[model samples]
Target: MLGEPAAMTENTGDTPRTLRLRADDNVAIVVNAFGLPAGTVFADGLTLLEFVPQGHKVALVDIPQGGTVVRYGEVVGIALRPLPRGSWVEESSVETPVAPDLDALEKATRVPAPLPPLDGYTFEGYRNPDGSVGTKNILAISISVQCVAGTLDVAIRRIKQELLPRYPNVDDVVGLTHAYGCGVAINAPEAVIPIRTLQSLARNPNFGGEVMVVGLGCEKLVSERLLPAGDVAADTGVVRLQDERHAGFGMMLDSIMTMAEARLEVLNRRTRETCPAADLVVGLQCGGSDAFSGVTANPALGHAADLLVRCGATVLFSEVTEVRDAIHLLTPRAASPEIADALIREMAWYDDYLAKGGADRRANPSPGNKKGGLNNIVEKALGSVAKSGTSAITGVLAPGERVRDKGLIFAATPASDFVCGTLQLASGITLQVFSTGRGTPYGLAHAPVIKVATRTELAERWSDLIDLDAGRIATGHATIEEMGEELFRLILDVASGHKQPWSDRWGLFNDLTLFNPAPIT
Candidate 1:
């Protein structure tokens, strides 16, 4: 139903077109690029009493003050005052509704039936000694503290300029630098989040298990702690700037480069081999969203996510606040009671976390979102959940945790694009499908990001940046299934090195920002 065109009425060339999502809905969104002016009439004979912007909602029926305003067949908000038919329904005119009660949610009552297996889908990937596969063969240098970031950057520049050519197979070298590791309460119970994030990032399948760490000698988070469990030791791939052997900045650069070249040599020997689709880990996220996000791009992504699950690939849908208001819809689709409880636990944890910060879930639908027709977080949440594709949620991962289970997993994270992308990297997503309605240039250094546009205007405007255009679904030019199949083939092609996404081609990667909730002291 999501990918299908909304209920459309016949319209002459001069008449405006609008989309009503459900028969029971009282509002419909304007589909024209530029909104229809007041007094314009639809083919249904519904005249606009006031001007409505594109993607903005208009009341299809009269309602009294405090009446429910519905969209997607759900109560998104309440009318603040009397609204006449065909009147523009803007954000200020709607009052946010209370969130669903998490405690009363049904668990595993409506789990989706297993989709028929989609087999024989495979990709060319680097096979690591740890038995994991990699989409890109890169040597990542981890850091124990922020102090060594500058030094590491210098060394990485030299490695790229002087050493990368010798090892043609190694994709790139990255410095896994972050603001954590020092000047914080490292021993705090909450500190495990960032610590584990760094650890998990080093273990990301794309890194090829050739972990290298750079540390300043006296940091609170020592270099050894950043290493994998059984591999921690002084002699194991660590370069300490304060070591007696490093007498000056030049020596420090040499030490890192020496260690880097060794790892690069090992990585250069790796080659892409055939791997099952099950080895693929994909992350689903949406940003710069508008109302069209729910109706177009997100639903198409959801279809692709469902396809990936049927193919035995691991898929992750994240952003706790984005999913908070729609938790009721998700809980019942959990694979089991334990997983359902895990979903609730992560929600409750984030709720408490937000409360402690004197914030609530309503602190969303940014100014850009308002202009793009998102009235509030509740409406945004309903649309945001579409990326999960009705798959039974099989597991949950807290912020910064590594993903362990297969199938669909909810990787909890803050909604900020950089933060969510970083945590998803930590969760082991080899490829990410990012949907944008208002549009963004967001990308990640560690993984390939496929940008999908929700509107045809955006796709045409940013043709070089957007990898796929779901906007055609809104115009009735493409169906959700067709877009899903297109996206799925694109994913395999990109994963197998047969294609490169715009993000990777242009190197438009954003910095990784860790979600550190512990004290600064």
Candidate 2:
């Protein structure tokens, strides 16, 4: 079932809508665009005692002072004062609850029954020599310093215009550029984060192991430092701009183009072969969230995520602050005690990081999130973590680290859309599923972003932008499982190059934003 109806029927005066997630929950999110007026009635016979803005919470039952307000079958906040039934529960009406202590968390207490194997699913993918598979046949050029980005972009455009057509097999050329290589304290302990991010990103599966690097020779980060040792192919692909052999910018372009062609030759010879679903590395995320996000889109995506796990694929769930509020609920679902410990470690590290900056998890739930009816981070997080589904978290990766294990892995990253997407790419995600209620034109150059809308109205309005619609689940037009299956099939098609997501079709790509926690000077 798709839960209770979200909108008022014709009999009710207006379409004053509300969405209740769980039976025990006392709050329901408003569904209509304009705030419903007092006396508005919902399908469930719940009358609005006061105006409730769209996407904000409405009290379904009386909440006494300090009483818990539940959502998602969990306590999201404590009522600061008495709240009568039908009252709007704004952020000021409730206080965020204390975070669950890390040491006392339950471990492996709610392991879900193994889902039936989704067998026989395959995608045509470029197989790499290292046993990894690539969804795109692109020749990617890595840059060792920010100073080289301008030169590299010019070179890439020239290559794409003059050289790419000759290599019919290669999809496109992309420069792996970022703001990290120079003018920073290179040896700072925190500097390792960006270094590793750049290093790992150079090896993303989409690159097909044909990695080339453009460098300003004297930069703190050398091309050799970004590529692994004994990787003769990658080492040979490095083109140093400041090398004596490059007399000027024109000569530098010559060297880069020469190196790029060599990699293109290797990438061109590669062909797509049928690969099992296990070869997929998918990243799950949510932004511009609203009440319907968890009720429809996120849960639907979670179901799809579970299906991917059943197919033995790797799925990554990230955004540190987004999940911090639900840490207590997640640690127990860890695959093992060690994995549970890892989850806590990442959470604790992020907590300390926030404290040092004189902030806390509450700083999340951006202005757009609030406008979409999420009163605070607690409520937003309760919905955000749903993208992970019910699968046991098999592993945890720190910010910018590479993924090593399969199943649902938590890759720690900031909630910023660009930063999260970039770090996920570094962690080897070949495809990304981003659920949005308020909507954004977020895209990445490194991977195809499959945008999903949480509401029907938004979907109909942004038809050309959104790839999938989980809103049907809320409107009773589709079940979460049906949407999930549809998404699963779409993932395979996109990964196989049989379909191009809207982001890719329009060539919409956001810049690669590196997460640099250390000092820049």
Best-performing candidate as measured by lDDT: 1
In candidate 1, stretches whose alpha carbon ends up further than 4 angstroms from where it belongs are 1-6, 10-15
Give the lowest summed-lDDT range of ten residues in model 2: 1-10
lDDT of 2 at 73: 82
Instruction: Report the C-alpha lDDT of model 2 over 200-285, residue by residue, as the tens digit.
Output: 99899999987778888899987887766676553486888778887888998888888889888998999999999999999999
lDDT of 2 at 61: 91
Candidate 2 clashing pairs, residues 3+ apart or interchain: 55-373
Please give, for residues 1-521, the per-residue lDDT of candidate 1 as tens digits. Answer: 23345586544453587878878889999988888899988877789998899999999999779999998888988999998999999999999999988889999999999989899999999888977788998899999999999989989999999999999999999989999888999999889999989999999999999998999999999999988888778766899999999889999999899889888889989999999998999999999999999888898899999999999999999999999998989999999999999999999999998899999689778998989999999999988999999788999999888988889999999999999999999999999999999999999879899999999999999999999999888787788889988999999999898999999999999988999989999
Q: TM-score: which candidate is best?
A: 1
The lDDT of each candidate is 0.90, 0.86
